[model samples]
Structure formats: structure tokens, C-alpha cells
Target chain A: AQSVAQPEDQVNVAEGNPLTVKCTYSVSGNPYLFWYVQYPNRGLQFLLKYITGDNLVKGSYGFEAEFNKSQTSFHLKKPSALVSDSALYFCAVRALGGSSNTGKLIFGQGTTLQVKP
Target chain B: EAGVTQSPTHLIKTRGQQATLRCSPISGHTSVYWYQQALGLGLQFLLWYDEGEERNRGNFPPRFSGRQFPNYSSELNVNALELEDSALYLCASRMTGSHNEQFFGPGTRLTVL
Candidate 1:
């Protein structure tokens, strides 16, 4: 079984300030984690992923996520937030070496990021 | 490169009717995935197709089904739709050897009246 959790329904931060959105996962095997951003009425856009190695992975739009094995977390972060960064963020996971090799993702409920200028 | 594309950006169907949503994967990508994003429900995996075969399905009932054509494009058919079926139906595609980074399309907004 694989699952992802975005603990916060929303996160607010001011422009030029650092921002973080929390995500945690539970999977039977090594986890394949991903982050996506969705604008209003737009499809999800891939941000970054953590498959293996490099606990810290940088992604599009100056966003990054750190994979914590012991803590079971993959939190998205940005050094400086911009108003345009405001959007719905999603965390997803898939267990590697699972019975099914299909690329099926189990998504988190999603976190709405609000970057106020 | 053309990303995944879904047809009929918005669909309206009455209860007990059937809805068919289509998707065309990116060039060279062979895997297609379907998901439902209902209001407040987030994204629920619906189906997965690779190499023109149904690879896996979610916990949806038999009424929710789909197929992949030889070209790797796919279609999702929802039979006997209910009001609760109203949601954004998303289609994504990924390369076979990729690390499950599925690129998504704009999606088809399915509204069951």
C-alpha cells in the first residue's frame, strides 16, 4: 500500500519570504515521491521528484524538496515566495518493486499555497 | 513536444447516461493514466494503460472502465453516471522507463446533471 499526506490544507507566506509545504508518505518499499502544482482550472504541472539518492532535489520554479527517510517526509520548499507561486500543490507517491509495475500514483489531498505580495 | 492532450475539455451528461473521455499521450510515451479529481476529494487513481493493455485499475466499480488504442491514446468510459460522478477527469502519460513522472493534460471536466 502507498499513500501521501499533505497535513495542511493551506499555507500562507509573504512575497520574498521562505515557504514550505509539508508532505509525508507511507509505502511498502522504496518510495517514488513527486510534487505538482495546479493553477485554477489548469492541469497539474510536474515540479520535482525524489526517486533515489540526493535527499535534496531541486525542481522547476525555484522549488525544492527534501526527502527524509527517518521522518518519512518529503517537504516542498522555496527560498523566496512570489505571488505567482500561489497555487494548489500536490504530493504523490508510488512504491517501487511493488507487485504492479504500472506507474500509478497515490496523491495527497493537496495543499493550497497562498503567496501574498 | 506535444504533451498529453484530452478531448472534449468539458462534458455534460445526465444521470444514467454514459460519458467517454479521450486522451492522447506525448510522442514516444507509452503509459497512460486516468484520475478523478472530485470536489474536495483530491485525485483518485482510476486506470492505467501501457502498450495498449489495461495494466491496472483503481477501486472504482465496473461502470468505470477504459481502453488503450494501438497508438497509445486512451479513452475512459463512465456508464450509468451519477451526480456524484461530476469531477475533473485527468489523463497523464509517462515513458516506460521513467521514474513514474507522469505528465498530465488539461483534463476533461465531467459534469453529471
Candidate 2:
């Protein structure tokens, strides 16, 4: 089984400050980790993914995530937080091996990030 | 190229009724995925269709079903709708062997009365 855990329901950061949203996962095999952002009333937008190689993956909107295999974590990060970045973030995982070639993702409960000006 | 697209941006249905949501994959894409985003539940995988075949489904009941067309479009049909079924239904598409990075549509807001 594959699962993702976003320990924080909400994270607050000041504008211009760095922000991090924590995510951890449990999977049977090598994990394909992803980060997605959802604005109000909109669908999820892909942010970044860690398929293989490179522990640090940069994505759209000045966002990035670091994949830690030992920690089983893929945490979203931003060098400088902006008010526009305030939205819901989700961490998702998919197993790379086994009979699971369906490409179905298991998403976390989501973390709401609030960047205050 | 155009991103994934979904139809009927908003839908309303009463309990016991059925709701049909549609999706069109991106050009050259061969897979479609459906997800349900309900309050408190976040996003739950609903179905995965690749090459006009149902490759995988989540733990949803039989009432939640869908099919993919020859052109790689897809439709999600939810039978016996309940109030709890009211949520945003999101559709995503991906190219085969594309590292499983899916592009999502704006999604349909389904409100079950």
C-alpha cells in the first residue's frame, strides 16, 4: 500500500520569508513523489515531481521540493513566500514497481499555506 | 498544446439521481484519470483509463463508474447520487510513460441535493 501524510493542516509564513510544507510517505517500492497546489474552487496544478535522480526538484511559481529517501519525505519549499502563494498544497505518491503500473496517485489530506503580507 | 479539458463546469442533482461528467485528454495523451475532492476528504482517486480500457479504480463503490472513448476522452457516471457525493470532480491526463505527471482540468462542481 502507498500513502502520503501531510502532518500540518495549515502553515503560516510572512511575505519574503522562506516556507516549507512537510510531507512524508509510506510505500512498498521506489516512490514517485509529487506536489500539487489548488487555488480556491480550482483543480489541482502540478508543482513538482521526484521520479528518479536529483533529490531537489524545482517547479512552477518559484516552488520546489526535496525528496529524502531515508526520511521518506518530500517537502515543498519556496525561497521567498508571496501572498499569491497562499493556497492548499497536496503531497501525493505512487509506487513505481509491482503490479501497480496504473499510474494512480494516492494523495495526502492536504496542507493549507497562508502567506501574510 | 491544449491542456486536459472537462465539461459541464457545474452540475446539480438530487439524491437517487445520476450525474455524468466528461473529460478530454490532452493531444497525444493516452491516459485519463478521475478524482473526487470532497470537503475534508481531500482528493481521492476514482478511476484510471488508459487506451480506452479501465486500468484501475479506487475503493469507490460500483455506483461510481466511467469509460474511456477511442479518441482518449472519458466520462464519469455516478449512480444513485447522495448528498455526500457533492464535490469537485477533477479530470487529469498524461502521456504514456511520461513519469506519471498528470495535467489536471479545472474540474466540475457537482452538488447533490
Candidate 3:
């Protein structure tokens, strides 16, 4: 079965410092990875996705993720952390072929990013 | 273009009651997906519909069901609701493509007493 794991329950980062929210995935075939952020009482907002191409994929709000094939990891990153960037981050994976064609995503237990000023 | 939209931003029901949630997909989107965001379960895929057909579903019970309309709008019906069913129900839509990303709506908060 396809699955996503976000090792951290919460990541604390100081303002102006870089932040990294870790994510790892398991899938039978090639994986389409995605990142989404949710704020208090709001729905999830798409951050970025790794379908194909460059290992590093940039997304909304100055955030980017590196898709490492060998490591089976797609880590969300930001060079400078801001208080507004704090939110719940989720990693999801969809298998490329076979019965997984339904496009249903397997999501990880979310990680909360807390950026302190 | 308008994004995915869901109605009844909040719904409250008692156990054993039935609850209905509605969603409107983005224009031109042919696929609709429903997910449940519970307290600790993360996000679980509930159903997937494409071209007015039920393409697939997750490991949820039969009480959780839904259908898509000809215009691509959809409705989720939960029968025999339980306290565990209290959650944020999210609706998402995507164009008919393997690589396209899904857009989400402001989910409905369902509370079961």
C-alpha cells in the first residue's frame, strides 16, 4: 500500500532561520508527491507537488521541496522562516500506475511548523 | 475561474442521524474527491468520482457514501452517524488527468453528538 510518513509532529524554527519539514513515502510505482498547508479552521492549501522533472520543486509562499528519488523523500524547505509560515503541513503520495490509478492520495500524519519571532 | 466550493459550512447532528454534505467542483473539472480530516486520523480518502461514476473508494464503512451529478457537482451522505464521524469534511476537484493536482474547498465542519 502507498503511504507517507512525516517524522516530526512539530518543528520549531526561529524567525529568519531556515526551516525543514521532513517527509518520506512508500509506493509500488513511481510516486506523485504533494505538500499542503492548513491554517486554523481553514481548509488545506496546496503548497507544491513533485510529478516529474527537477528534484527541487518550488511552490507558493516562498516554499520549495526537494524530491529525492533514491532516498524516497520529499522535504519541504524554506531559506527564511516567517511567523506567517507557521501552519500544519501534510505530505501525500499517489502511485503512478496499476490499480492506483484512482488518484486517491495517501497522506501522512501532519507536522505542525511553529515559527517563533 | 471559481475554485471548489462546499455548502453548509458547519453541520450538527445526533448519533444515528443522517447528514448530507454538498460540493461544487471547479468549472471544467470532471473529477471530484472527498476526504475526512478527523482529530488524529490525518486525512483519509473517502470517495472518488469521475464522469458521474464512482471510480473508487477508501476503506470506509458503507455508511459513508456519495454520488456525482451530471454537471460534476457531488453530495456525500453519511448514514447512522456516530461521534467518531465528527470531523472536517474536505471536497476537492481535479481535471481528468493523471498528473494534475487537485484543488480544495473550505471544508465543512461536521459535529455529531
Best by DockQ: 1
Distance (Å) between predicted and true CA of A75, model 2?
A: 0.6
Question: Which segments of candidate 1 are over 4 A away from where they belong?
Answer: A100-102, B98-100
Tens-digit lDDT track for model 1 on B54-111? 9899989999999999999999999999999999999999998857599999999999
Q: State in Å the error of residue A11, model 2.
A: 0.4
Query: Poorest 10 consecutive residues of model 1 chain A by lDDT?
Result: A94-103
Worst 10 residues of 3 chain B by lDDT: B94-103
Task: Put down candidate 1 lDDT per residue, A1-117, tens digits, no spaces.
Answer: 577899999999999999999999998878889999999998999999999999999999999999999999999999999999999999999777758455689999999999898
Q: Residue A58 CA error for candidate 3 (Å)?
A: 0.8
* DockQ (CA atoms), all models: 0.89, 0.89, 0.88
List the candidate numbers ranked by TM-score, top first: 3, 1, 2
TM-score, cand. 1 vs. native: 0.98
lDDT of 2 by residue, B1-113 (tens): 88888989999999999999999999999999999999988899999999999999998999999999999999999999999999999999998894769999999999999
Binned by DockQ into CAPRI classes (incorrect, acceptable, medium, high), candidate 1 is high
- Model 3: per-residue Cα lDDT over A61-94, one tens digit each: 9999999999999999999999999899999998
Mark the regions of model 2 whose C-alpha exceeds 4 Å error after superposition. none
